[model samples]
Target chain A: MSRARNIEALKNILIVVLFLTTILLLYFLWENVTMKTFRLSSILPAGSSHSLRAEDVTRPEEIVFSFGAGGVTADPDVDGRYWELWMNAFQKYCGRGELLAEEISRAQFLQLTDYRAVFCRFAYDLPLESFCQQRGISNRGLNQIACVTEMGYSAGSPESVFLYDGRSGRCYRLVSELPAEGFEEIIRAAEQGEYLVYYGAASLFGAESSAVLPLNYSSTLAETPCGAELGGADDAERKAIAEQFFGADFGFVRRIEESQGSLIYMYGYDQKTLTFAADGSMVYREALNGEAGARRDYFEALQDALDFIENYGGWREEQGRHLQLRVRDAYEIESDRQKGYRFVFGVGLEGVPLYGGDGNLLTVEIYGRQVTAYRRCLPDGDLEKWKEDREKEAFSVVGLLSEGYPAIYEALRGEAPPPVPPEGEEAPQEGAFEWVAARLQNARPGLVRDAEREGSLRPAWVLCVDDCDFFYDLYSGEAFGAVPRQKD
Target chain B: MKKVIMALVLVLTLLCGSCFVCAASDPAVTVVNPQGNSTVYADNILISVKVTATRVLKITVFEEKLLNEDGSLSSLDSLEALGQVTAGSLRHVVVSPAETFYSNGNLSFYTKELKGITPGIYKLRVTTLDENGRTQYLQECYVVVRPPSEAKALSFQSEQSGVLSFLQSFLKNIFGN
Candidate 1:
């Protein structure tokens, strides 16, 4: 009986062991499946708007822009006689067009209306609908031209400024926010009685005359005066156009103010802004509440954003003339239990991305499947005109590995300085091929400019080394700048 | 007869002691920093995990998609790849074998300075193994990543209890044994 009881006890232990072994085997299988699924999702797209397929991603084209034009670096040839007449007309409107000649010569005086009409002839190129005013700066009364071209003083594009030449007691104040490159050359030319007429693209280092038009004349010559022919839509028409762009026009009506030739329809109460130019260009901005709803999945938010842009952004899929907008990156925001995604879209001209000096472009914010904010500054120009065919020489990637990158890595690692050995010890040396295996991450073509200084947008090879950026200018073939990576 | 009874009592005592060890000394995995349901303010989060295993440890961070019944993660998707490190990379605590039972220790991972991490929920999954090719512990914790300015200081813990502890508590509750 004792032997039989022992056998029964041993059999019970065997059964328990088998049951536990099966459970353990099943647990492991489930664990592996869960891990595999996690890995697969990372490589896959987050969904429609937040995720991008390999084919859908745009590979930006690389191009280099030359700096100098006609052997002069960003300098324009000025037509002194036309400028003299234009300034005189401007001064006459300010009650001094003919009086300037008393300080110089009477034959040089020109009629204000005739000059305005002539300047308005290139209204498409410059802002010319400005009203003249006299303002005292530094105790000297100067002729102030508020809006001199097609640009608005407030926004849309970078403020396009015409050269301001004002007289302060026998001294001339050549006022320019963007002083052209080779200002010394311009001053020497002006002293010789030759005026420089600047025309073409803005330079990185202020104004360099790309084309020169010398006015070889002794006096301010006045010809036939052309009439001001620009016209704009009424309040109702403006409201209708704004509604078409915004899809939902719900803001309180406010006064329409005209500045720098462009009519801006300001919608108060909600801070919605709508700007329009009778020349068929416009800019619109709207703000929405971002903290009130459950968030949508990635694709849903992306589709909503793209649909909003296509309907109201004045950018059409078929119209190749508008700036081609592409997704630069997407950031997910979770704060205060409020979740959202901010998508930054880059403006591409032809195949090259256009970098605004202010890092300005289109940015859309989506919260809870709805777009909460939209902001963009679409400049009006033929984008194709700026496209370059020949790629210029840029600093080689191999060179970046050895030269600019080592310093950046040292800063990240916090390597200690070598201890001094005796009074005149030699410093320790790094291995010849030390950084050879240090790979660069997230390399791509980006349009970047110096935010602190005035500069034109240029193509740069933006790469991540220790999560910080190293911008290599394609034109200058040098290390442009480094931006420390923003922390979460 | 008295000797036989004594031998029987000794064998029974040995069996009960072995059962106690089986019930109490199992491995456990847990997230230390950014406790479950807590909001992470810093962009580069310092991730710390505690493990009680003798062999290799694999820690993974996944952008969680769904929530399970116990208010934990049900599914996961990878957003960024933070490569693997050794389980013993960082020494955490010094406890005796009798007190810890398993190799109770901690491992920390520092994330790269990420640019625009969408504010959302994420899951950190940790798996550990024993020396004899046996699974030790597998557990996950959920966290919220957000900007510092918008974060709320609220913390709650929801971890998978060790199997031995669960059984102990269950027996104590049911039988008061």
Candidate 2:
């Protein structure tokens, strides 16, 4: 009975072993047949290579206006003039009238006189005495000396007047010219100090000689002696002088209200005190050589100046706070010219901003199907105060949104939103992530396919996951939940 | 009589159990080159066979010869023990066909070089033994040696102007034009 039982046990053991071997073979066969098949046709295609479209992004809502004396010359008929016509045009185009034009021109003329004095000091290097004696002329009289100096000097010559100033140990030359009509008004507004406006060309030797004729506007200088001096004149007399010179053709939109978008005001200088009429036209009296003033215009230009003030000028009181906020765990996106840096606060579902980078508090009001961002500047000392301010503004919580979330979503899923439906029309059923994934899959099917196809082994797909998780899972095969939560 | 019957049955069972145990512990063997019917020269050729198992393995190469008219293996023997493969993780053996010779019906030659062997038919037998000193597997192959002159004639004919050259010229003309 014991031997029979042992034989039966051996048979049973062999049967069980055979069964286990069969199961193992079947599992291997199933894995080889089903999971290992290469699927090459599912790769997506490449996207279009095109320039960025401007209409897709938001633009600033305000305008900036400014006036300055230097830029490219647009007018061709200023009579061998170098800087006057350009300065005049800049002032005119920015809506400062003939008064500002007079101020800029006079200041430029004075600046040219300074140029001519430097030119005279260098004239000795060229044997000017021999040249003058040979030509029966003198460099003493203001008019005659200026004419001789103009003939002796060329723009490209290495001989420059400023170069001789230090060598000669003489005070710098000052040019005489008329001021703009309304100079006093602007000076009073600046409230800095009283300034002098010389009306005759003074040499490095401290001589007030009228011997040299003005290189530009010789006929005008001949008509008015001592040019247009404003010395010993009261404010009323200065105002009258501005009226006489400019003739009441002031051009400006009076009463610029705060509600007309944002206003950017700039202040600048001419040789004389600049005067402005009630209508914001500029004039100068007894103006110095160089024209100096701020220029402003709409949209991007104002934004640029404001951005400069915010970044480099240290004019904005809250700049430090803004900079701190911007540098904190935040990615800063600067403007194309590097003039402005915009901190992306948050993105909404459709890649639209819940609040702009301009520190505007956005409130969404929904009456029907329309959505509008009612923007207002944030209060002091609180960057996140916009959220509370927006909440108090009777805005509706139509959706949970952040300004930069759509970009984050695109980075994760590899696509962005599709075209929005027309008004009163229903949007498509595909969610943003699904749409992006489908687009990526369509572009290169190999990415979503079971196996890689020809020419489709690219590294773009690695961007879909957070960095910490990507490396963690690559080494340990265990997911590290998210990068943002890793430190915690 | 009943006692004798019981003893016979017990002996039969024990024999079957021993066979099962031996089979279970036997090594698995595999023969790699000179597969089935292959060609080989009469000079020395390396005959390699692999024997794998959970434990150690051993291999041996034997050249079998035919009988003489006296019904005995001739003194100029074709059959010989080429070499013994060591019992270890892996073993390889080189058989010298020059030391071996063909007998009445068998052709076997053992040497260290395969250069000067005539054309003939031969057999290679491989035997494997497990670490426990039990025969585990046996493999055999028949190899034919062709004369070197025939191989040279084949190579010369291949190089002569043939259809391959004609087709190559035709393609060059088609593509070049």
TM-score of chain A of 1: 0.38
User: Candidate 2 — which residues are off by over 4 angstroms?
Assistant: A1-488, B1-28, B50-57, B70-121, B150-152, B155-164, B173-177
Q: Which candidate is the best by lDDT?
A: 1
- Give per-residue CA lDDT, model 1, range B93-123, as digits (tens): 2111111123322211211122244455555
For model 1 the local lDDT of residue B138 reads: 57
**For candidate 1, lDDT tens digit of each residue in A168-226?**
21211122223223222322333344222221111110111111111111111111111
TM-score of chain B of each: 0.40, 0.42
True contacts kept of each: 0.00, 0.00
Model 2 Cα lDDT, one tens digit per residue, B1-177: 765665555444433332112233322333333434444322423343322223233333333333345555421111111111112211222333212221121111111113243344344544444456555554455444544223211111123243554454345434531
What value of lDDT does candidate 2 attain over all alpha carbons? 0.25
C-alpha lDDT values of all predictions: 0.38, 0.25
Candidate 2 residue lDDT tens string, A1-488: 99999999999999999999998778557433233222211111211211111111111110000011110011111121222222232222223211110011222223333211211211111222333333333322111111111111111111211111211222212111222222222212222332211112121111222112111110000000110112223444433333332333322212122353322121233222334322122222322222222222112222332332222112222334322111001111222222212211111211111211112221211111111111122222223321212211111100101112245455465677554444335444554422322222000000110011211111111112221111111111221222221111
